[model samples]
Target: MVASIALPRLMRIGAGASRLLPEILGQLGLSRPFVVTDPYLVSSGRTDTLLERLASAGARGTIFSETVPDPTVASVEAALAALKAGDFDCVVGFGGGSPMDTAKAVAVLARHGGHMRDYKAPRLQDEPGLPIVAIPTTAGTGSEATRFTIVTDETSDEKMLCIGLAYLPVAALVDYELTLTKPKRLSADTGIDALTHAIEAYVSRKSNLFSDGLALQAMRLIAPNLRRVWTDPSDRAAREAMMLGATQAGIAFSNASVALVHGMSRPIGAHFHVAHGLSNAMLLPVVTAFSAPAAVARYAACARAM
Candidate 1:
């Protein structure tokens, strides 16, 4: 089957990929960038490296570091206010899915001018947002490349999954070196999230030839290395492999579709405030086991692949 896929015009992956952010911005003629990240990245000095990179090129940036996990509408609002308050010429989404998603929201909303819910799932705002350079600290969600962002509605507790050309990053710097210091549980959760992406993409009713290959190779790379990296946090080889797999799986699922797991997990996350990835993880085994009977041959391949 045929499907639609969108991506960043620029994606830099591998070790030290982040170091090129300055060069990336320079080539694009972007000088004054507003950096969007969470306090965690700020405290951990992840934001510092990015700042240094910009400074190296004599570029200036203002920091907006209040983003929270599973970013909410309120959080995006705060970021948008900050963006407007600062005289930022461009934007940099720096961190994991939450902060990155928040950055995307800020970029889009700043230009588009409206409440987040005003641009919900059924709506696709094609207006280009501010130029956003994405630098992903975690490999999962592939928010750096995809055009989707889930921001929670505090009043209704709905995970408002937003889609549009406005959400796509203009550029991405995916450095595996960043994941080496991540704690084990986060590593496990995001790794499983990547696995879920691959599996869902492979089994999705919307699956296509292009996405199937990405999903297959994603599973091949991630399934083995997930545990290895989880067990030995400092395992560079495993860490690197898992990071690549996570990004690949992100590409796969974004091109195809994540079915029942995401559909059901979103509700659980809304109700229980369980981390989206954890909620998805807890449901995976049971959902797969129950659904395995529907396509025994394909599922057997999945089991073997895992």
Candidate 2:
């Protein structure tokens, strides 16, 4: 079977990586980017820091901090309305999966002048909307590099999985330094999410040579570093490794596609408002036990690795 792979055109990985945003945008020739993030980032004043960076780079932007954890179709529309009212030439996503996902959906629906449902799966959205610059503050979800966005539809109350070329980022700034203040709960959940991504990608029916390599490395890096980061939050090297592992897992799942856990987790996220990562964590053991019968070797390997 043929396979496909996609990721950001540019990536900057390291400590103090976020400080390169202005330079990165300049390199990409983007000005006047709309910032799509959450209230926490804004209330915490990381928003201002970003704005200051943009200003420093001679760029201008509108800050849209209204994205919800499970951003709804209504939320997408709200962001689109705001985008239409601005002269944004690019989009910047800063925060966890929620904000990053919101940025992606907004980039698509806003630019294409269509509803979020218009880009639903089994359909490949060929048009690339405004170029996106992702800065992930969490070491999970790997939303920074992937070309897939899991979004919620208010009409059906289902998390619509939008997959294809359009969801990819133009650039991703992965600075583990941003994870410094990540709460232990978020660290645990995101680590599990990354773990799920690696495991599912490894066992996916669509898994291939390229995705397998990425999945293997992701598993190796994430398996050890996840617990380390949890136990010692100040371990800079561990945090950095986890961050990279998450990104690698994102690449793995993006190319290989995720299976049952994601299939079921999306529903719980839509129905119960459990964060996607946490929901995946809750289901990991039970699902592993069930799928173990069918894919015993893969499950056993993961079990031993964990």
Candidate 3:
């Protein structure tokens, strides 16, 4: 069987890649961008700095900074309202996973005019939406590279998994510099999340040669450096490695699939409000132990790679 692979059309990865957002937008011929982010990034002045850069490059950007953790349907609808209020040509996801997921949901809704639940899993939305440019401030989630978004339905308390090419960002700016100021807890949590992504993708029954290569590489980059970054958040080399590894893990899982850990983790996240990565981290050890017998060589390979 042939494996189908999907990824951002353009990616800028490095120390200051986010600063080149205007350039990426220009390359895509998009001028007006609706920037979606959380309030913390806005209060931190990072959002203003990005908007300033965009303005300097002659791109008009509108901000929507109310995205919540886990990205509720109400929040996505609010963002969609803001998006529809403008003649924006693209959406810019300017923070971690929540903002990115919100941006993806809004982008699709802007074009398709539907509720978030309408795009849930088992319903593949292949049609493209407004272009999305993802600039991830954190080194986890890899939402920038994946064709998936999760939005919670507040009424139902369900974390709706939206899948399709429409949810994928057109361009991604992966910069390790953005992760420098992240706290130790965040570093550890997201770091383990990335490692879990790699391990799960490698052992998944849906794994393919291409995804296996990426997963192995991600594990190699993330495993040794995860603790180093946690120990010294200022370690540029470790941060850079972790950032790249996270993105690779994202691509790996997107192309292949995540296994039991993710399956078990999502409910914990939705029910108890545990952070996504922390939930994954909590479950990975036990999940791996239980799953190893079925994929012994695969688990062994993951151990060696890590």
Tens-digit lDDT track of model 3 for 117-232: 99999999989999999999888898999999999988887888889999889999999999999999999888888899899999999999999999999999999999999899
lDDT of candidate 2 over 1-306, digit per residue (tens): 778878799999999888888998899898889999999999888989989988987999789999987888888888888888999888899999988988998888767876888788877886888888999999999989888887788778899988767788899999998898889999999999999999999888889889888888888888888888988898999999899999999999998988889899998988888888899988988888888899888777666665
Worst 10 residues of 3 by lDDT: 153-162
Which 10 successive residues of model 2 have the least lDDT summed?
Answer: 297-306
lDDT of 3 at 28: 97
Best-fitting candidate, scored by lDDT: 3
Which residues of candidate 2, in runs, are more than 4 Å off? 303-306
RMSD score of candidate 3 (Å): 0.7
Off-target runs (Cα >4 Å) in candidate 1 are none
Taking all chains together, the TM-score of candidate 2 against the true structure is 0.95
The CA lDDT at 293 in model 1 is 84
What overall lDDT goes with each candidate model?
0.86, 0.88, 0.93
**Rank by lDDT, descending?**
3, 2, 1
lDDT (Cα) of model 1: 0.86
RMSD of each: 1.4, 1.5, 0.7
lDDT (10s digit) by residue, model 1, range 124-203 = 87788898888888757778877788899989999998888788888988888988988888888888888899999898
